[model samples]
Target: MFTKRAFLTLLAICIGGGTAYAQSDPLPSWNDGAVKKSITEFVAKVTTQGGPDYVPPAERIAVFDNDGTLWCEQPIYFEAAFALDRVKAMAAQHLEWKQQQPFKAFLAGDKKALAEQGEKGLLTLVAAAHSGMTTDEFAKSVADWLATAKHPRFNRPYNDLIYQPMVELLAYLRANGFKTFIVSGGGVEFMRVWAEKAYGIPPEQVVGSSGVTQFRLDAAGKPSLLKTAKVQFIDDGPGKPAGINMIIGRRPILAFGNSDGDHQMLQWTMAGSGARFAGIVHHTDAAREYAYDRPSKIGQLDKAWEEAKAKGWTVVDMKQDWKKVFAFEP
Candidate 1:
């Protein structure tokens, strides 16, 4: 009983509305796969009122690893590269560094020699490079470094390497009444300087390996804390859950990570009584992003990868699960 013109106009409106509804996905960067479906379904079940899995808004805590999980940790950890640069910058001040073992090896670009020093050597590099500055000064130094530093392979600012799908996932979770925290192995003060801008997580919400700090009155009578070489805590592997317990005081209902370092955190989250979610971001996109696991020194995913399947954790294949990797196109 309608005119041909009216019928055509009605069809256009219906199609347009349908298209808008379809495109309103919160996690647009994630592909329509089981990985994405799992995240949404978990959030839905926990949030639905009167559902058996319903969680109070205050209990919806989610934790994420920073280095390889939120951003990139390929080739080497970004902070390690920063320490190397610091060594180069300070070489001029300490002429005797040329004779120092690890410093000499680092300055001469002899990576093989540096590797022989192992974790102890790397800690020495970090202590020499990162300490001897006040907390405020160190924070400023970190901000300055991040502003200019670029990933060697990507040739983009380090902050720009954040995974788009993961960013979307963070926002989506926050919108669903979840409190997100960054539990990283990187320095806590270093991450706090820019985490709010990078991941929308505040300084107090970041828990990472920390060094001892000494509070003293400066010449001007202003109180300041100077970072010392002594280590306070190392928040990786088993330390992750311990750090979460100490910092957050409550076990998270959901946890996301990328390497074996996160295995314990995921385990702790899964061990919780209520509805829980654990996810691992498997780095498989060799073309778009660097891929190395188990055999590699940095960000090894072997044990976690094996346990993920057994424990029913969502292992996100970067190449297949994500429609895109970095927020910016390669």
Candidate 2:
């Protein structure tokens, strides 16, 4: 027979042991499925000391695409929405915008017409909305936009739509010595303002599309960096790999993306020597999130989906693999 104190100690140990086991799951929002299994197994194999698949802490870099992989990007990209809002706000000053092709279409709420203008029209909108201001001014505008902008369907702030499983995965990877980065096709300065707070990735670790900037002195002789309309880097598709090479200087061991734009980045990551992990977040949950792939102009997943199948990369089925999508309750 055990004494009362000994019984209490045994009970405490059992409860503590159970709690430890329960809390061991790093990705609670991820269902117990192949996607979760593959991620955990890969981490375990790479992290094990003296194991064949062990990767050095210095080389443990993971790169993620921002728009559709980590966050929801349905209806239109968050950045695109921001540009439209900016166009509206500035339309008063530049009344000529109401008569222009792309701006006119966007202002008139003509989605089809805007899409017909294609990439050229989109760039025009971006340049008009993003340029002609100091970088500091641009940053402030972006911050202000993000503070008030809400997704159309969800009615929640864009940041709240970030995938919970991916967030957990990022944290888990960081805890295991992986340096995570956001390699987005969005504007560099725009993301730099909030990426750290939103994703735990510092501004220095973010590589994105950019416009040219030049140092200048204002009327008051205050030094400032002015954003220009000239195109600098696109940071999409082939440019994704180029941006990684130029900015990060190291090939990532792991890459996560959701569309064709991220194809080359995934290819570049897997082409490196050693064990690599490449994942594509397939948006299959129509009920929880919008599902679009081949025909969708925004975040199209067609080419990358086929490539992922051929290359044996992990394809995360959002509907089947995740117990929850957003971090917040609906």
**Structure candidate 2, residue pairs in collision:** none
lDDT by candidate, in order shown: 0.90, 0.90
Error of 1 at 254 (Å): 0.3
Query: How does model 2 score by TM-score?
Result: 0.90
Residue 106 of model 1, lDDT score: 86
TM-score for candidate 1, residues paired by index: 0.92
TM-score of each: 0.92, 0.90
> Over the stretch 1-330, how does candidate 2's per-residue lDDT look in tens digits?
799998888688676534445357878889998889989998988899999999999889999999999888888888989987898888899889888999899889999999999999987987899999999999999988888988899988888888988988998898789999999998889889988888899999999999999999989999999999998999999999999999999999999999999999999999998789999999898999988788888899988889899989999999999999987754
lDDT of 1 by residue, 1-330 (tens): 799998887787676444444337878888998999999999999999999999998999999999889999978888888888887888899999899888888889899998898889888988887788899988888888888888898888888988888888888888889999999999999899988998889999999999999998988899999999999999999999999999999999999999999999999999989899999998888998977778878898989889999878999998999899897883
Candidate 1 at 208: error in angstroms? 0.4
